[model samples]
Target chain A: MVNEVIDINEAVRAYIAQIEGLRAEIGRLDATIATLRQSLATLKSLKTLGEGKTVLVPVGSIAQVEMKVEKMDKVVVSVGQNISAELEYEEALKYIEDEIKKLLTFRLVLEQAIAELYAKIEDLIAEAQQTSEEEKAEEEENEEKAE
Target chain B: MELPPQIQAQLMQLQQLQQQLQMILMQKQSVETELKECKKALEELEKSSSDEVYKLVGGLFVKRKKEDVKKELEEKVETLELRVKTLEKQEEKLQSRLKELQEKIQKMIPTAQ
Candidate 1:
């Protein structure tokens, strides 16, 4: 009986460790989602900017170059696999919007996962408490019998 | 000197759940890291003012048009986003199973004060 209780205690400890790790992962995901949302907003604003406007473009970490938009109608877009094509401004905006939709969907999925993890962790905590109580009761009963 | 069969089974289930949770957490960490990198790349691309951009293809930087680089970054971000979604779905399923197993054990074990 003592051995069995020890095993259960070990299992409970393992479960607690796993739960902590998962909680950390959820926190990281929250930060990632926030960053992605910010990036999406920036892209949307870029789409709305007027075509014939001067913009400061970063050349490097410390250098910024000012350039006037000459061809707002035709913008180059990467097709995939390192291939790019010239696309109209509206088309590029549409493409970006689609990407943003995908990101939002992904974020919803992540939120669902975190919720499920929390539920599981709650159940585990309850189970651990029950196991510990059982172990204590068994030990007390043994001591009483000896007395 | 043997544990009750029921108690042994409960321990096994708990161990399995712990392992599953560890695996899911690892996958989530990797996906989150990849997503961060994709977002950073997109931001850098957006800030560039030059028409010419260099794209990393097969471990080499190839000259590409700025709009094309932006599009590529967008595509990468989309792909990573989809990957994260799939991993999250898997995590949800695993957690549900773990919860079910835990509840079953709780019911089987007699409550002690």
Candidate 2:
């Protein structure tokens, strides 16, 4: 009867490690979200050089921004609520921040739950192990009595 | 003539528990794979769309023909952008599915001692 298919100890230990890794991932996501939010706040803080709206800016709201960043060469930064959703970069950064925040929050709750599950699984495994050991002891005692 | 029947029942229960765990695990794996694929597709779509935008509206060339090229690029970028938007929506849907599958796995966890 003691086939030992689900070695609860090992399984529960694996589960604990899994939950810990998940927690770390969530923390990483939280950091990323914070960083993106900072970038957006920086974008919002950018000084507008002011240009007439002749589609003067692609997406038109960015006006103009000058820099030597080289990475963002030929690019402009726009402000205003409506402008946030139009440009791909602007929209992507903004939404990715939001997604990471959500993912972090969800992961936090899930890890807590998974941790509880692992604790329970550990308990079950221990109980099963003990029960098997006791059964063997009983069988030995009975043999001694029979002899 | 035999040992207790409870042992048999316990054995059966444990087996059932093991099967249940396996089923849940399989579901988790499937959902994880789907999520990974969805994200990969979305990333590729986003990259291609960004490249399109850059090609079309990339410069501030003063020549009239250059301006026309820019205008055409912008229009193409706009249409490609809608595809990206659709992909975003699909991504969000998959994200929600991921959450549901995770919760289902949580629920499938067997009882502790």
Candidate 3:
């Protein structure tokens, strides 16, 4: 019985550890999602720029260089895998929106996995309680018979 | 009472297996991320209107043919897919082994009652 209790405790400990790790992963995903959303918003705001519009480009956090917007209809964006492509403004918006959608879907999957782990933990706790209660009842019965 | 040597050894082995599983999970996550990036790049490449694309090589943008970049990304995606599959198999195996060891230890220990 003692070993059984120990085993249950160990299982609970392991579950808790896993939950912690998963929670950390979810936190990272949330951060990434937030960053992507911010980028999306920023890109949308760029629509205000007109062709040949003068703007200040920040240089290494020290000085800003004045530059003319040669074209506002298209922008260069880093798609991924160290590759950048020239995409029209509308296309860039679509790309960012797609990324956000994918991340949201991934986050939902993680949330579901966490819920399943929580359910398993609850079941284990209930089993541990039942085991201990049965042991206690048996002990009390033995004591009464001896008396 | 002290735990028997056999049980102690099993517990140690279980701990090591748990660590290995955690490592595998981390690797799987990283690989999956890379795969996602590759897929995203491919999608963008297909949708792009430009005849030529720029690939970042050693902090420099080297202009390349669109087909060449697309082929490179496709190969990367294939390799990453294989890695993810192998890691998943290892994870499944380790999980089952852990469960078996736990059950074995539970059965080996005599019930106090």
Best candidate, TM-score-wise?
A: 3
The number of the candidate with the highest DockQ is 3
Q: Considering only chain B, report the TM-score of each candidate against the true chain B.
A: 0.78, 0.42, 0.93
- After TM-score superposition, the amount by which residue A19's alpha carbon in candidate 1 deviates from its true location, in angstroms, is 7.4
- Give the per-residue lDDT digits (tens) of candidate 3, residues B1-113: 88888888988999999999999999999999999989988988888898788989997999888899899999999999999999999999999999999998898687521
| Residue A142 shift from truth in candidate 2, angstroms | 5.8
Candidate 1 stretches greater than 4 Å from native: A1-52, B1-113
Candidate 2 wrong stretches, greater than 4 Å = A1-6, A44-97, A125-147, B1-52, B55-113
Local accuracy of candidate 1 as per-residue lDDT tens digits, A1-147:
456557656766766676677667667756755765665565555556765777788888999998765555655555443444454666655655666676667667766765676676567667767877988899999999999
State each candidate's clash count. Answer: 2, 0, 1
Clashing residue pairs in candidate 2 (N, C-alpha, C atoms within 3 angstroms): none
Predicted candidate 3 versus true structure: per-residue lDDT over A1-147, tens digit per residue: 889889988988888898888889889988988988887775665557765777787888989999887766776778889998888888887877887898789888888888888898899889989999999999999999999
Per-residue C-alpha lDDT of model 1 across residues B26-89, encoded as one tens digit per residue: 9888878877866765664564445776665786667877776677677877987888888788
Q: Could you give the C-alpha RMSD of every candidate to the true structure, in order shown?
A: 11.6, 14.6, 6.3
**Candidates 1 and 3 compared by TM-score, better number:** 3
TM-score of chain A of 2: 0.45
TM-scores for all candidates? 0.46, 0.36, 0.68
Query: What 10-residue stretch in candidate 1 chain A is worst by lDDT?
Result: A78-87
User: Which ten-residue region of model 3 chain A has the weakest summed lDDT?
Assistant: A42-51
